[model samples]
Target: MARVQHAKDVAAERLLSIPGVHTVGIGYKRRGGEVTADLAVIVFVDTKLPRADVPPDRMVPLEIRFFMDSSDREESVPTDVVEQARPVEYTHIPAGTLAGRARPVAGGRSIARAASGGGTLGGWVWDGLNDEVVLLTNNHVLGGAAGTDVFQPWGSTAATDHIADVVRTGTLDATIAAPVNAADVLEEIEGVGPAVFEITTATVGMPVEKSGAKTDHTTGWVEYVGLTGHYGSTNDFQVAPDPGMPNGRFAYYGDSGSLIVERTNPSGGSWKRVVGLLWGGNPELGNAKAHQVQDVFADLNLDTLCAGAFEEFLDNLFAPNFPEEPLKVTPIQLPEPVTMPLTTGPRVSLSGALLALQQAAGRPFARSRPLHRGMARDVEARLRLSRMGSDLVTAIHENRVGLARLVLDRQTRRALASAAAPFVEGVWTADELLGRQVTEEDLARFHRVARIAEDHRPELQPLLERVNRILGELPGRSFDDVLR
Candidate 1:
């Protein structure tokens, strides 16, 4: 038994590495119309299962069979090996144009057909990994890509229906749709009911129930855990074969994406928790399987959203200005608040604007002081750029287009300081005038705000363009040159 179980585990890992093999598991190999205790690794490739009319001994496909020995080595079983191969299967919700919900939509009901507009909505599930509500269904159901519009009650009834946006898409044969309105979602399933609050794992022989678009409600037993299918592998459950149904199958074609939940208590009304996302099954053989929900979420990286939020919370917890170590036990004492004076806008008069421009340039006006004979040439250039900026602002306000253009060009060149700008220590540009730490950030911020203002106020567009042009050029000079 231990060898068989290890063989099962090793075979599953090997098949998973091979492309096109969907799921893997360990089950009794059927021989001469009977299941043998001799365990074999069951693998589902993109092949079809044998129909009921085919005898069990003849049901095994000749193309594939793999086995593991006690030494944990994999060898292809001989073609004469009669072990039955369960072909690839998928949820079978049928294609239809039906509409009009008899009530608010719930899981296991018909939603939109596949993005191909064909399959059924498997179910609705809460995304536990992320703190948001999502309508759970198959990737095939939601158009197999992000941005598919999911319609409630089928896309057939276009008027007076609900819509949700597909947000996540993946190879697990699963997609999650987030609705526009939160209230439209229903927590309770449609039939064979379980109100899903949390997801649980699957165990072999676990009694599970599923409500789907086609079957409505049905009960099944977990036959194999960790089985792979064409798109990906997880677990496979066998729907109880019922003689009354077509081919004795429990679910029909439209049941893809159905939620499989564990029945907590067999004899009483106990809560059923979600165990898997049903995608496909064999009608003739009564074999079916689903991707485990937790596995699906993890594969899709859905939990990363929660991790980002947790990081932000941690940042706030350790913020500075708190009491020092030994005194840390005491409540934090915030520093006294600083008050800043508010100004409406730049000074309106030409003289006042010129003074404002000088202050903004962070340098003395040319006429304010006598320059030393050996002073760097860029100092005089800086003063010239500030004067030109003040002149351009006036020209723009007065609609002197030609003068504004010429002054704007000169000012922009000066801001770049390619020739007239000096490098300041540890600064990209003008480090001596503006501290190294805040130079880049403050200039970038100013550029962004001016660009936005140009978009909203056409009258100020010319002035704003010049402002942004200068800010963009501010990073060209280095700190050493400015100090020299």
Candidate 2:
């Protein structure tokens, strides 16, 4: 359910900026009396029906359905206007206190210390197997090994004040510290409510709170989940910084291990549920990435150690809103999450860009292998007449513009231009089959390919430009109009 909601959130973030889109939600698409899970983007206007021109179509794998909020409906405002209260942003409490209720240690306050140094104590957790309580923080904060001396207020607190011992290390940059006195720690957190035994998975757009050594208590929104950042794969998620808060970054350098929890309504109680363990993030992007608690617990092998307790908790966490009926068709599976890999090469490839565009436009007609071979052959045959076929192929393969331009003289240009007509026609051959679903992905690919061509064959620029304008028309635009 969280996964589905997260997908909807990604779609909403991309679509909300469009002129007409009012709201987005998780819903079902029915075909032949069977329901398929999908994200529905809703737009309502008393005048002309508006279409949401969502960008980066590949962001969410779910099939998006544009819904017009009929003019006849009684309600004027959007249905999803209900907002969750934001968590308190700052704390005046001093550091050195135990996590939770002990002396109100704000999120940014430093608590636990290790051999390398001290780090902010994020939150607390229960050792279901040993029947003991432990302070939850980042593995990097606790020396990433057992028996590290944990200090309160760090070594800077009037000479080292040892408070606990590092017990275990877990995936997702998490560690458990067995406090000398289990009862000394309180369940209550500064600003936020108590940390409940209940755990919740991250949902996109969900309000959440966290405390760290550098920024104290802060609140933010869940921007994404199942995100693969520079941090190696797995179930990691991201939190967008709260613009209203003073904290500059969601998670700072010393803030690793901060525990993020769901925001509770009405201001106070034990309603807050564990959500994520903050490891690191890019502040420039105004987001912090954390490992989802479900994945963290699973990596810790808690299900095997705690047996029934773990399974019961998971059951409650993942229970459906209503009993789900089987669907006629298999639901669309989201692509495996990946942040662009760090490498020194062309960020976008011609064939790669074309492939992404085809999928986005619902026109996965034929494999790019056939198209690549055909295009390469056409270019080859034309350049061979100029006795520069190998040079052109090497230039294209190496992405070298000067070499390509030198080889593509007027005569070769004329031949390539003529050959390009057949290749371009193939792209639209399945337009009827795909319903001409143009998207930003296609526009971007066209622009990128055109820009590369501009660096080589200037004559081909106008041709690709025309192709882009033609495709852009299907989603609501004209040849001369700006993309909507």
RMSD of each: 25.2, 28.9
State the lDDT of candidate 2 residue by residue for 388-418, as single tens digits: 3344333333322222332223343334334
What are the Cα lDDT values of the candidates? 0.51, 0.49
Most accurate candidate by TM-score: 1
Name the lDDT of candidate 2.
Answer: 0.49
Worst 10-residue lDDT window for candidate 2 reads 80-89
Judge candidate 2 at residue 102 and give its lDDT. 34
lDDT of 1: 0.51
The list of candidate 1 runs beyond 4 A from truth reads: 1-5, 12-24, 29-40, 43-102, 113-115, 128-130, 157-159, 234-247, 266-269, 301-484
Model 2 compared with the native: what TM-score? 0.42
TM-score of 1: 0.49
* lDDT tens readout by residue for model 1, 1-484: 3454454554556555644345566555666657555555665554444556554532434323345454455554311232234544453434422223635566776777434443455444444333244677777666556556666665443634545667677767788876545446555667645344446677665777777666666776766555645474544444443345444555657677777877664424323567777777665565556777677756654421222222222221222212223324666566987679987976354434654553343212111111112122233334345555445534443432222222223233233233212222222222244333336655665565454444434555666676565555566443222222
